[model samples]
Target chain A: MSELVPNKSIYEFYRLVEEHHILLAFQGMMTTDILTMMGKNLKEQAEDHIFHRRIFSVMVELVQNINLHSADKAYSESDKKMVGKGIIVLSTSADGKIFTVASGNLIRKSEIESLRQKIDHINRLSEEQLRDYYLEQLRAPEDQDSSGLIGVARRAKNPLAYDFIHVDEEHAFFLLTVPIHQQNSDK
Target chain B: MENFSIKGSNYIPTVHFDAKSGVLEISGESYHEYTVEFFQPIIQWLREYLATPGREIVFNFKMVYFNTSTSRRFLEIFDMLEDYQRSKKGKVTINWYYQNNDFDMLESGQDFAEDVNLPFNFYTF
Candidate 1:
């Protein structure tokens, strides 16, 4: 049993995390309870209330995006329900000036085009335009799903970065990165 | 209808909608996952309350944090109030409370105010 695991790989994983300035990382079932717990812990790591609120709001939106749309699913006995599986990584720039919330989850390959178009459309908007777009979508209809991404972009005040890596004929690994600058606290 | 009240958690807000006083208040942090589903009954209660001809309504939104998903529902409530006021059935007032330094929250209030025709009072604690 001892031979099944390698010490060198474990040490390397630790080094990788340290090098990335990762504050928190979790990969597993995405449930509301899990979100609440993670949010509480993450809030504890920041002293500035306004900054943490921004991070916390972004984290909630990103986690819900996974919970609502991830193609990967698993049954959790503790939760007594089926839940989405995804990864969330919170890291800071080396200078500690910007915090990045990175997330990944499995998504249907069919969704790639639509997702790309939605994100690209958001990335092209100016700040004022983004706000107007958000309000416009919010007023469109309750079923519209585009407002979440708009809200995220508006709050982050930065273009979202994304990548879709094909994993199989039917599924792809979707990665989204949103950077929150600490200076935005003044805004 | 009797007074509607639900205790808040770390993720859900405390909702107190008084049918008698016509003062509906939602306070605390709200980041619930099933946002639409969670707010349905509350919205229904409002619908029922607004059924009568004349009833003064004071809606207080004392939220510290709510996700973007919740924003749509908030807008729905504002729209309902706007409609109610426009119909000349009752007087409506909205008091939006935010923390002193939470400008994002304040801006959200301002945005909602600008979107609707109802009176909105902004307060900071």
Candidate 2:
């Protein structure tokens, strides 16, 4: 991968995506229009429109979260100067069955605690529990940004895999990954 | 009441609902920046329809894709029908259609059916 793209920025990441069979990659400045475009692309590429739709929707929901609610905002065009800036990538496994969706973004030092708790809560849920969580969030009023992460877990047919890397300046780079969990099993 | 339609985008689901026919169809992909914003009016319309529904409603979802936020909203529609089915019993039927080749769709439809306990008929193309 490194020999293919010597540069470590965009070239390296995109190369990694290709090698790993990453489906969709969302890095740098995530906007509504671009998110919408990504959704359409997923629909076109997916075997199951519903499955594709959910992943696309989750991407839009979560990435926009970084755009809107991130405590750190980077004001730049080339790279993310925003505090809550990050990237999301999607790719299929070698088998072409298990789809992996991964998102990485920066978060405030203070916000990390809450985000961690939320992720933990989601991870703890069974499918039924996640459904309950989703229902609980839905029954309440709208405009709540908190449920977006939980919604991803709830909607996932397979267990959501995640990790966090703490960068400098009281900012943590969080990675949330989900696998479709089938080896072309048709489900 | 008010009729609206938003077609499929790369990351958002396709929306096609008919107010007059009381037949709602949501299919294709879904991943949008503004979920609640996009779905708000539709939810409201369902609320309105429940108040004075038509003779029969056949809600069909050929959704092969939907995220958690959208999933929650979909549940709302189902719950509405189940509740509506109580007083307005047997007036609504939700066809949770999926491609025969896809196991995810079948399981997903079954999951929703189990939650609502409604006979979500699974159809194959």
> What is the interface RMSD, in angstroms, for predicted model 2?
4.0
lDDT of 1 at A158: 88
lDDT of 2: 0.68
Location of the lowest summed lDDT over 10 successive residues in candidate 2 chain B? B29-38
Deviation from native of the Cα of residue B9 in model 2, angstroms: 4.6
Candidate 1 DockQ score? 0.78
Q: Give one digit per residue, the lDDT tens place, for model 1 in A1-187.
A: 3675589999998998999999888899878888888788887887898888888888888888887789998886755667789999999999999999999999999999999999999999998888888888887765456888888898898899999998999999999999999998886
Chain B only, TM-score of each candidate? 0.96, 0.85
TM-score of 2: 0.70
| lDDT for position A139 in model 1 | 76
The C-alpha interface RMSD of every prediction is 1.0, 4.0
| Runs with alpha carbons beyond 4 Å of true place in candidate 1 | A1-5, A76-81, A140-144
Scoring only the second chain, what is candidate 2's TM-score? Answer: 0.85
- Residue-wise C-alpha lDDT for candidate 2, range B1-125, written one tens digit per residue: 77657777655567677877878888876654456677887788778778874447778898765655576677777888888877765488788877766665676677678778566677886
Best candidate according to lDDT: 1
